[model samples]
Target: MAGGRAPRVLILLCILHLHCLQGAKILTISFVGGSHYLLMDDISQILQDNGHDVRMFYQGYQNMQGYEKTSVPYAVSTYNMEEKYLKAYDELFHEYQREIFISRDRPQSLFPLMTLYAKHCRLYMNQTDILDFLKQENYDIAIVDPFNPCHFLIVEKLGIPYIAFFAGPFSYSLGNGLPSPPSYVPMYLSGFTDRMNFLERVINTFMYLGSYMVEIRNEEIFSGVIEEHFPPDSRPTLSDLYNKAELWIYNMDFSIEFPRPLLPHIQCISGLRAKPPKSLSQDLEDFIAESGDSGFILVTLGPIISAVYRMDFIKEMNSAFASVPQKIIWQFKVSQWPKDLKPAPNLRLLDWVNQNDLLGHPKIRLLVAHGGLNGLTEAVYHGVPVLGIPLFADQPDNIVRIKAKHMGEYIPFYEIKSDKFANMIQKLIKDKSYKMAAMKQSVIMRSRPFPPDQQLLGWVEHIIRSGGGGHLRPYSYQQPWYQQLLLDVILFIFSCVALLIYIIVKVIRFLIHLLYSRKKQKQN
Candidate 1:
């Protein structure tokens, strides 16, 4: 009877543990871009596969028809504000392109562009219908891309813990209260590596501070919007709310990124978008096979900037491609080819191509890209050298890192003469060192103990099981900025040093006076 009872007790405990691991209601939010949406979709699918109920709220101009194919349900809200933002983005892209190529000094201030994005996010959240839907969901957790603080407000209103899903390298703002000394870690968008000279450090520090200032300004703007939507008592500052995230999953790998200290709550989830190379269409396969000894080059500017380049620039690129001996596969935006410009028989232009699939091909020699993170990761994964033509955002930084690693070179768009472009392409193709370095980095990137997707799923499930994983958050999160920076300690030390100096000076003066008095008395 006793043995039977023990077995029953064990079985009952097992049942309880299974029940505890049941599905959770997850809410995901992100701004609408192909790369952003794809990342969020991957996250949602992973959670849903594990028996979690996942829903998404996205804002942007891109069509959401792609979501229909996914099992996870999502809602997209686009207002007239998207058109305004798109127009602004187009103008900014052109301006940035010109600044990168034509001007000696590129504009340092990204505050205005960041502010515009913040306003667009606010507009999306302020919609009554969107807010109502979010409220109705009764979500258990909110996973948000912290590009803007507006999602923090949404999660606060929903009354649930949220996670920060960084789509790029770990952001400095996300490391608030944590020990990320700028002495080593490069500031986002600074394009400097960890190794820096005195001047570079000064510039890096200024850029770091500037980014924080921008964040603070946006926070104030967002705070007013949050206050308007919620009761005064319930209104939470964006800074306070942002730090409340239970976990931070940054799309960074230490192998690729500079070494930096991270709190326990932060996890690196880089290369989640990477997957096994898929089969290319028969035509593409045949094209690569026909490339013969001199392999092909793949060129793409990613999805957003496909239409941003001017025709004259496109013509110049075409001319450069004509000069190169290697076969070229260029992903251009327009279907109609330019009538006047003639390309070499080896050049092929297409509207779209399976980028990863092409990179993984043995006949492919190099990649010419805009340095988007996804494209960079693919090139690195396949061990292909790159010639980056960076435009804006993280592109410049990404290219700088690639060059630092000796994996590629970049050509400024304004300097895109046919001879120079052809020579650069030829150099990358002929140089075995670039290919070797890329292959070495590829080993490091792929050496993780587990697959990236599995690692992500495991951490996410851990968070869900532990109910927001609050214990993982560091004590630093609650500390004041001065405390976090040890500024108070520095001030105390400075005061002590000043007091010691004063006492030493006073004693010296008294001794001098005593000696002078003695000397005068003797003389009398």
Candidate 2:
């Protein structure tokens, strides 16, 4: 070959290589309140790091707002968290475990409550705005957490591949019969923990059905607006939305989360756990170095729950730590220490410190947390056992999983007196079992084929490279559950048997009528 031809051939190969490595520029749209964004942001960064473009469209409220004005490529949608919503959420979260919908107790009760709560923060929020943003950007695929089932319809309109990101302990696959997480600790049983019994399952079923209604409503609202505003060839249903999606990136590991049958499209990528920030400030470093190996306890109630209960928990924890020989590092996120409550020699409080770093530090032994999944992941990541004080939603479920794994112990939030808190702390630290369990999980969690961040990128690349294969679509509710169980055939047989019985009865009546007419003639 000529020299010029060689260069041309090389150029062709390079282009082929680039095309082979081609990944879709993923556009992630997440709701405000849920912790979905935390996982999505990590996925987004991984995509970006691998030379794939990412654009985030989030309602600038709550934690999502923290990324605002940062160098990340993102756009803020019209949803903003109002003061009233925050106040109302605070009130609800205080008793969240009592009120969370495990099943359909009411129509549009659980989801609408959450959406309405979110809407109270931002009024003019519509599904169209999100669609319009998607249409303009022309994203290759849309990654959404299933909680925002409303947004799934956006993918149907644009004919794009979408994957619902499940970012918690639970799993929801199409073919999985119904949406049931491994186990949920009953709200009524505060002390004794067990799986949802028959009644709870019935209620949970109702709640799931109610969520379906909300999904339909959301689809109608979105499709109706699409029909009004833009030209549409065909309107899409909720089923259509599921069909168009390519995959479900379940944010859980099989090792940590129990094995459940999942759809072909669903893949477990649970390793993408996170802590606030790993790097500590100079003051934190100095504090850790000067602690003289007393082994501090890192206390945090999580972000939302922290706002309400932090001060009280801090005071009680302080009281408990007074007798213990260990130091205390409280993650308060504010410098407003009570003037009267002077800092003890062993106690240091900061508004915010790198949570993972604190856990990984040699000086830190135990974590006092509200049992959020992220905190649990970090605790497990560093092999530090927890004294879980769960607040709401999946916190109780998470704590149950933690304790079941033998990695941690849980104390009910209502039972968080100083003495009890101190006893639990002492039990976790002094006992070798908790750390051993955590270390076992850590070893298994680390032994995975790839880091969660890289695994996430691979899935996205697969979508782009395969041009969004239909094979990756989740089989959720696709097969009539009746068909799967051979119930349809059973019903057909029952109907046929009934028809045969009816025919026999009709023939018998006809014969009797004829016999009666003959007898009347003879009498005449």
Candidate 3:
């Protein structure tokens, strides 16, 4: 009996230990462009390395080193190339892009594109082949970037846990309030700026108002697509979509982000940047060594912003580099440099370059960029001050925040003249404020209690440790903006005060009239 009891206890202990080991199949869908995949790849790699199985879905290849990737079932090729819908999509994309470039504050402008993107994502999710694959694979949780909101919704509908990877500084991760960052007014305690100048607060309020409207419209558009594709019974209401979000891993650091509101289910695990390769190419090494100590500025507009679109700016940049003592390293994808433009002694241009490693080096002094979130992260990670030449989309918002933090300077893409560019570079290079601000942010980023990659793993594993989507519910989106702000209470009190004033005035008039009449009669 004693020997049997000892064996039973040992078996029970083993079972408990096995139960504690959290190993689940994580399905990730990354259907956006190269920059979006940067965020996706980081999270997926972290999960896979931490004893979890990951199946990654991708539309395009950006980071192609050594990661397992499964192609999205139907990408751009499968779509019927009907002129009307294609034109409609193109027009919408252009309009949105234009709005992002010129608008003073347009946080919700991306919703229209997001809805169109969601429609295509749903189209792919509908195919019979995908249905078959879905039925065969057993997944525990599906982590998707919010840009591909439909896939996450599908995971939620399946009663599996789903998480969103925030690619930039958007408030979508802050809950169902809106897709923009928290109101830029009164500056959240942990915001990048110390105080909102009058103009900035006004702009922030406009953004808040605009974001509310956009979220309402996006919900309608998002729900309509689901209703059109899936049966009424199969789809969840907009409320259900936000509620199913088990965790949101933000690719932002607290130093750069405003103070976050409480959403117990939401988790912030930002600064998950891709690490640079161990060594640099010979050409790059030679260029770094030849710069003669003063170092250089790395100018890039990322992979999406074609050099052709930015050729004029490059001309200005070339003119600017002519005067500066510092050398310049440009990540040029195009083959042709303008005929009139002569390559300077201190200038070098490469088709493709390692941006992160370049920024990390002690030789690189300033970064002139298009202000994509990835580039911003890199500049901050290396404590390099920047001159933001924002193009479109979130670039404007990113630059504004970048400028607000005093970490860099910003110039509109079209307005960058050679003289202006050169002068700006000279100011940034000579001034210590910009460098100090960047270094401060970098320290804050590094000082986080846990590494961002590890933090992401912990939050993901926590979701698995708990049950999937069961912990988070969808009641947060129920109230409208007016009600949430208690505008009704203000209206009610104002109405009561007005009514009381009217009643008092009427009573006083009546009393005066009666007294006048009585006095007149007595005199008569």
Candidate number with greatest lDDT: 1
> lDDT values of the candidates?
0.75, 0.64, 0.68
Q: What TM-score fits each model?
A: 0.85, 0.75, 0.78
lDDT score, residue 339, model 3?
Answer: 64
lDDT of 2 by residue, 1-524 (tens): 59889999999997996775654567776664435776666677777777766777665554421223345644344455567766665566444433432331232334545555334323323455655666787777878776555456445555556777777654234322333442442221122234567777666555544554655665554454445433566655555555556776666765456545555666788757643346677877787677576678888775544444445655776788776777788765454556567666777766555577788777778988877677778887778888887765557667777887888888765556778878888888889999899889878877788887878877877777677746654353477757867898999999999999999999999999999999999999
Better of 1 and 3 by TM-score: 1
In candidate 3, residue 214 scores what lDDT? 59
Q: How far out, in Å, is residue 432 in model 2?
A: 0.5
Query: Residue 169, candidate 2: how far off, in angstroms?
Result: 2.6
Instruction: Compute the lDDT for candidate 3.
Output: 0.68
Measured on C-alpha atoms, candidate 1 has an lDDT of: 0.75
Model 2 TM-score on a 0 to 1 scale: 0.75
For 1-524, candidate 1 gives per-residue lDDT tens digits of 99999999999987886575555778888664557777887787777776777777775454322123434444343344556667886677556545554444332445555566656656776687867876787777889887656677777877878888878765644434445567776777777888988888998888777767766776766766776777977777777876788888887776567777878888888787676788888988788778788889999876434444456777778888887778899876544556666766788877777788889888889999988787888888888999998877677878888898898999877778878888999899888999999998888889889878888778877887777767988777777879978999999999999999999999999999999999999999
Tens digits of per-residue lDDT, candidate 3, 220-267, equal: 777766777667677775555665577666666666655545455566
What's the CA RMSD for each of the models?
4.1, 6.7, 6.1
Model 3 ranges with Cα > 4 A deviation: 1-22, 61-112, 157-159, 173-175, 178-194, 197-203, 274-277, 307-311, 336-345, 469-524
